[model samples]
Target: MITQNSINQLTYEIIGAAIEVHKILGKGLLESVYHKCMIEELKIRKINFKSEFKVPINYKGVDLDFDFKCDLFIEDLVIVELKAVNEILPIHDAQLLTYMKLLSVPKGLILNFHSNNIFREGQKTLVNEHFKNIPK
Candidate 1:
């Protein structure tokens, strides 16, 4: 089982990658740029992840054909959504939450890489009931 510490470490790794992307691209680039760069960073780090992973939503007991594509699913335990907005918005969190529910993931990270100062303004790690229910 994935632990909280593992999730946090992965978040920090992704945050470091985001900071680097921000440093080179700076603010104002579209979210796609950040998403692409982060994928490269994850590759360089040899981290296991699936980009645009298709998450199947359950309708009743059967798995539906339609799916939600998450930006990044790390180690099959965490979900990541990338954004390059001027500021983090409420809908962003809601979107991640929805992804978590659909993906059956315990933790998710919402990364906004367009901030002038990334350390102070660019990231959020969200934990759901699945994560909380895990034994420490």
Candidate 2:
């Protein structure tokens, strides 16, 4: 049973992992480099995660072939998108939101690795409503 508190704790852990990765690798590297370093850090921290996991697509009840691939699926809990860019833009957040919707996930994270301060400028977390059709 995933809760907001659990999600928040996990988010902190993930951010810590990202900071460790940035500390080791510094900036100006490829996204893959950060991805790999983060994975290593997660391993050292005993965090369970999957990389490049398949996100199936159902089209009118038909499953599509390899529809979407998530960067990191952590404990089947959250989607982690690794970015090696100057800043994380709205499009990046939108992309993660789309992944959360399609995967029927409750939460996601967007982590950028090309920043001087990874914690301050690199992490963005999001959550989606379980029932998204409510009137606001």
Candidate 3:
């Protein structure tokens, strides 16, 4: 079983990679640019992740044609959503939360790469009931 501590460790490493990308690239790049750079960083760090992983939508025992593509799914435990917005928005958080609910993930990180300080102000980590039940 996955533990909260383990997921926290993985997220910590992910944040470090994002910080490194931010330090080297600085702000104001496109979201796709950050996404690609983060992919490389995660690779160098040997983090197991799936990029643009698809999540199928099912409603009332019916599978929908629409699906949600999460930016990154790390260790199949956490979702990493990349953005390059001017600021983190409520909609972004809501989107991540929705993804977590659909994917049944414990936690998620929304990393916006357009901030001057990525670590201090560009990241937000959200959790759900799955997270609450995880062992510390």
Candidate 4:
């Protein structure tokens, strides 16, 4: 079973992978570039994930034919959003949050690959009530 501690540890690993990718690739690449590098890093780290995972949208008890795609779905528990923008805006956070809700996921990370210091200035982790309910 998934636990809070496990999720935290996985997030740490995810951030470490992102940091390694940034260290090698530096900045100014496209989001897709960083995404491919991240996937490589995650594979090197032996982390299970799905690329471009799709989440269906439902409204008024009806499922929509179209779906939203997330950058990375980690262990079926966390969502990773990749960005190559100058900075992470509120809309980015909103987008991740919306994906989390639609996917019924507990946690997510927004990793922007456009900063010299990716850890300090380029990463953000968000959790929802599903995370709160996880056992410690």
Instruction: Name the best candidate (by TM-score).
Output: 3
lDDT of 3 by residue, 1-136 (tens): 6788888988999999999999999988899999999999999999999999988788999998766799999988989999999888899999899889999999999999998887899999999999999899
lDDT of 4 at 18: 94
lDDT of each: 0.84, 0.84, 0.93, 0.93
Give the least accurate 10-residue stretch of model 3, judged by summed lDDT: 63-72
Candidate 2 lDDT (Cα, whole model)?
Answer: 0.84
Residue-by-residue lDDT tens digits, candidate 1, 1-136:
5677777787788778778878888888888888888899889988889999888877899988876788999988889898888778898899899999877788998888777777787888898998898766
Q: Work out the TM-score per prediction.
A: 0.90, 0.89, 0.96, 0.95
Candidate 1 vs. true structure, TM-score: 0.90
Please list all clashing residue pairs in model 3, or write none if there are none: none
Alpha-carbon deviation at 34 in model 4, angstroms: 0.6
> For model 4, how does the per-residue alpha-carbon lDDT over 1-136 read when each residue is reduced to its tens digit?
7899999999999999999999999999889999998999999999999999888898999988875799999999999999999889999999999999988899999999998888899999999999998898
**RMSD for each of the candidates:** 1.6, 3.3, 1.0, 1.2
Candidate 3: deviation at residue 120, Å? 0.6
Per-candidate total of colliding backbone pairs: 0, 0, 0, 0
The CA root-mean-square deviation of candidate 3, after full C-alpha superposition on the true structure, stands at 1.0
Runs in model 3 lying further than 4 Å from the true structure: none
After aligning candidate 4 to the native by TM-score, how far in Å is the CA of 48 from where it should be? Answer: 0.6
